[model samples]
Target: MAASSQGPVNGVGEDKTSVRRQSEANRKLKYISLAVLVVQNASLILSIRYVRTLPGERFFTTSAVVMAEVLKVLTCLLIILLQKRGSLRAFIKLLYDSIFVQYLDTLKLAVPSLIYTLQNNLQYVAISNLPAATFQVTYQLKILTTALFSVLMLRKSLSRVQWVSLVLLFAGVAIVQVEQEGKQKETTVSSGSQNYAKGLVAVVVSCLSSGFAGVYFEKILKGSSASVWMRNVQLGIFGTFLGLLGLWWNDGPAIAEKGFLFGYTPMVWGVIFNQAFGGLLVAVVVKYADNILKGFATSFSIVVSTVTSVYLFGFHVDLLFTLGAGLVIGAVYMYSLPKAASPSSSSSSSSSSSTVSSSSSAHSRSHLSNSDADSETDAFLPKSVLVK
Candidate 1:
C-alpha cells in the first residue's frame, strides 16, 4: 500500500482512530449498565409494592417477602452459571477444602447481604404502610447511609465537599420525616397499630442492613481478586438460603403456593423476574461502582416507583417528600465528584492491584502444588481472597 499525503499511509493514524473508537465503546458500555440498573431496581420496587394489594394482605405480604428471599438464591445460581466452568470448579473446590474459607469466604458476605435484604424489605413495608411518596423520601437516606458505611467499613474517606453534601442529604431526610409526621392520617384497619408497627421496624432494619452490605461489598472487592460478579453470586446464594430457612421456620410455604407450577399468571412471573434479575443487577452495581456513583444511578428507581404508584394506584405526593428527594439527588451528585486523587486514594488503588497479583500467585502455586493434568485448566481461573 502507498503512503497518503496526510499520514504514513494506513499505519500512521490507525492507532488514533482505534483509541477514539475504544473510548466511545467504553462510554457506551457505561450507559448500558446504567440503563440496566434503573430498570432492574424499578421492577424490584414495583413487585414488592404489589404485595401490599393482596386481599387479606398479611399472608400474601409475608409471602412476597419470602419470594424475594428465593430470588436471592436464583441470583446466586445465575451468577455462578455466568462464570467460566473452570473458574466455578476452582472456586468451589477451594471452598470445599477450607472450612475457615468456606465460612468466612462464602458465608461472611451474607451478613452484609442480609443487611441489604433487610433494608430492601423495610422500604417495601414502609411504602406498603405510609404514603408512597413518604417511603421515597425516607429511602433517599440510603445515599447517606451507604456513604457513611463506606467510610467506616473501608477506611476510605470522602472529600470535605462530599461530607458537606452528605450532611445536606441527612437534612433532607429529617425534613421529610418531620413533614410526614405532621401529615399522618388515621388508619382504617382494625389491627392498623400492629401492622404499621411491625412494618416500620422491618423497613428500618432492612434499609440499614442493605446500606452496610453495599459498603462491605465494595471493600471486599478491593481486597479480593474475584470478578465483581463472583463475590456477589456467593453472597446472594448464602443470603438466599439463610433468608429462606429463616422465613420458612418462622412462617411456611405460602408464597411457594404462588409459584409457576399450575396455570400461573404474568403477575407471578413479573415478581420472579423482578426478584431474580433485579437482585443480580443491583448486586453487580454495588460490587463494581462506587456507592456515590451508584446512588445517582439508582435514584432513578425512586422516580419510577413514585410515578407508577401515584398514577397507577392514585397515591398522593407531599411537598416535604419533594424536598427530601431533591436532597438525595443533590447528595448523590455531590458525592460523585471525582475525588481529588490523594495519597490515600492512590494507595488504596495500589493495594487493590497488589491483592489481585498476590491472589493470582497463590492460585498458580496451588495448581502447581497439585501438579496434574487439570492444573492448566485450574490455572485459568482467577484466585480470590477473603476480606473483611
Candidate 2:
C-alpha cells in the first residue's frame, strides 16, 4: 500500500512541476514582448515627426492615413500573390469576396463610419495641438484606461497586484504630464495651459475611441464580410470623402489643392512604411504572443515613447517626471500577468461532471444487459414449453 501511494504522489508532483514550468516560460515571453512594443512606438514617433520636418513634406494627418490604408490594401494583395501557389483567379476572387464583400447593409456601416470619422478627426486635432512627447504620454495611458474600463465597464475582475500596478501607472503618467507641461511653459509661451488641456482631452478621446474600435472590430470579426483590408479600404474611402467635405466646408473649394493622388512624397512613402510594416510589426508580435508577453513588450513603451519624443526631437525630460513614467510602466507589467486561478478547481469540475456521466452510462448499460439476459433465457426454453 505504501509503494502504491508513493507512485500516485510522484505522478502528481511531476504534473505540478510541468504546469509551473509552462507558466514560467509564458511569463518570460510576455516580458520580451513588452520591450518590443516600446521600440515600435518609439520608432513610430521618431519617423512621423522627422517626416513632417522634411522639405516638401505633404504628410498632413489626412494624407498620412490615406497612404497608410493604400499600403495595407497593397500588402493584402501581395499576401494573396505569395499564397497563390495554385489557381490565381480563384484565389483572388475568394480574397475579393472576403474583403470587398459587405455583409451589413449601407445603414449598418453608416453609424460606425460616422463614429470612426469623429475619432480620426479628434486624433488629428490632438496631434496638431501637442508635441510628440505629450502625445506619447496620452497614448501610453491606454494601458491604464483599458484596465480601468475592463474593471468598471466590462465588469472584469483583476488581481490585487494588477490593481496596484494600475494605480502606480496612473501616478506615473500624471507626474510625466505635469513635468512635460512645465517644460512646455518655459519653451513656448504662445499657448496657455488651456490649449494643453484641450489637446489632452482630444488625446483621451482618441484612446477611448481606439479601445472601442478594437471591441467593435472583434465583434465584427466574430463576424464581417470584407477582409480586414477591404474593410479598412471602405473606411479609408469613407473617411477621405468626409475629410474632403470638412475641408470644403471650412474653406470652400477656393483653397482646395488639385492632384491628391497621394502627392508621391517620401513622407507619403514613410506613412505607408509605418502603417504597413513598422506599426504592424508590433501588432503581429502581440497577436501571436500571449497577454503576458504583450505586457512585457509594451512595458517600457511609455518610457521609450517619452524618451524618443524628448531626446530625438530635442525636447525636455524632467527626472522626476521620467521616474513617474517608469512607475506607470511597472504598473503595465503588473497588469499583464496571468491570473492565479487554480488548476485543481478546473480538475475538480471535470471530475464531478465525469462522475455523473459515468453513473448514467453505467445504469443504462446495466438495464440493457438485464434485458439481454432475459431474452437469452426465453430463447433457451423452447416457445411452446415456456408457455406452461
Candidate 3:
C-alpha cells in the first residue's frame, strides 16, 4: 500500500524533472539564436569593410548585389526544402500554389524590393568611400527614417519618448557626419572632400530605401499569411530582376569592356555570402525574438563592428565620434523600452480572460509553427548552434 502511494509521487517528480529540462533547453536555444544573430551582423559589417580594401576591383557593387540576391534565393529554396520534409517536388508544388494564391500580394512588394537592390549597391559605395566606423555610426539615421515611414505608412502613433529618441538619433548622425567632414578637410588627399560628399549622398539614399522597404515589407507581412521564407523568396526574385536591370544600366559599358565578373576574388565572394546569410539570420531573429531584442542585437553589432574596424584596419576613433556613437547607442536603448499597458486594457483583459485564453491558444499554435520552421532551418547551421 505504501509503495502504491509512492508510485504517484514518483510519477509527479519525473514529470517536473522533464518540464525543468525542457525549459532549460529552450533557454539555451534562445541564447544560441541571439549569438548567431550577433555574429552574423558583425561579420556582415567586417566583410563589407574588407571588400572595400581589395585592390583593382571595379564595379563590384553591381556584381556583389546580384550574387547576394542569387544566394538569398538559394537559401530560401533550402529553407523550403527542409520545411517540406526534403521533398523537392512538394516544395515546388507549394511554390506554385503560393504563386497562384499570393502573386498579387508578392507583387505589392516588388517596388520595395527594387528599392532594396538600389540600397544594397549604395551601401557598397558608402563603405568603399567612408571609414567603416563612421559609416556604421552615420547609418543609424535609418532608424529615424524608419520611424518616420512607420508613422506615415503604417499610421502608427509614436510615444513622446520615441519621438525624442528619433531626435537624438538625428543629432547623433549629424555629429558623426560633421566629424567626418572635419577630418576630410584636415586631409590633403586629392578628391577626399568629393568622395566624402558622394558617400553622404549614397548614405542618404540608402537610408530612404531602407526605411521605405522596411515599412512596405511590414505592411505586406501583416496582410499575408505566407511564411517568412516565402516572402523572402518573392523579394529575392524581384531583387534579382532589378539587380540585373541595374547592372545593365550602370555596368553595361564596363561589362562590355572587361566582361562580367571581371574583378571577382575570394574577398568579394565572402562579402556576397555574408550579405546573403546575414539577411537570413536577421529574419530568423525577427521571427523568434521581440523587437527589443533585435534592437539590442543591432546596437551590439555596431559596437563589435567599431572595435573590429580599429583592430583589423587600424581605424582610429576620436572623442567626437565616441560621443556621437554613445548618443546613438543610448537612443537605440531608449527606443527599445517596452510600452506600459494601459489600465483600461488591463481591466478588459482581466474581464475577458476566457476569450483571451482562446486567442492566446491560437497564437501559441502559430508561434509553434514558426518555431518549428526555425528549428528546421537551424539544422543547416553548425551542430553547436542548434536552436533546440
Q: Evaluate all candidate structures by whole-model CA lDDT and list the values in order.
A: 0.54, 0.54, 0.71
Candidate 2 local lDDT, residue 144: 61
TM-score against native, each model: 0.70, 0.65, 0.83
Query: Total clashing residue pairs per candidate?
Result: 8, 11, 0
Top-scoring candidate (lDDT):
3
Off by over 4 Å in 3: 1-16, 187-194, 339-388
Which candidate ranks first by TM-score, i.e. highest? 3
Q: Is candidate 2 or candidate 3 better by lDDT?
A: 3
Q: Model 3, 129-218: lDDT tens per residue?
A: 777777777777877887898899989888888888888888888888877788785542843433777777888888777777777766
Q: How does candidate 2 fare on TM-score?
A: 0.65
Ten-residue stretch with the least lDDT total in model 1: 379-388
What's the lDDT of the predicted structure labeled candidate 3?
Answer: 0.71
The CA lDDT at 122 in model 3 is: 86
Tens-place lDDT per residue, model 1, 1-388, is: 2345656545436855765696587567667667766666565556545645545524333344445556655555555555546487765664454324445666556676565445544555665665444555565565566667877776777788888888987888778667755544433343353244454555555546545666665555443444444554565565556556655664556546653233234675566556555554544433333434455665776677678878766766677777877786677667666542442364344434644564575575465434421221111111111000
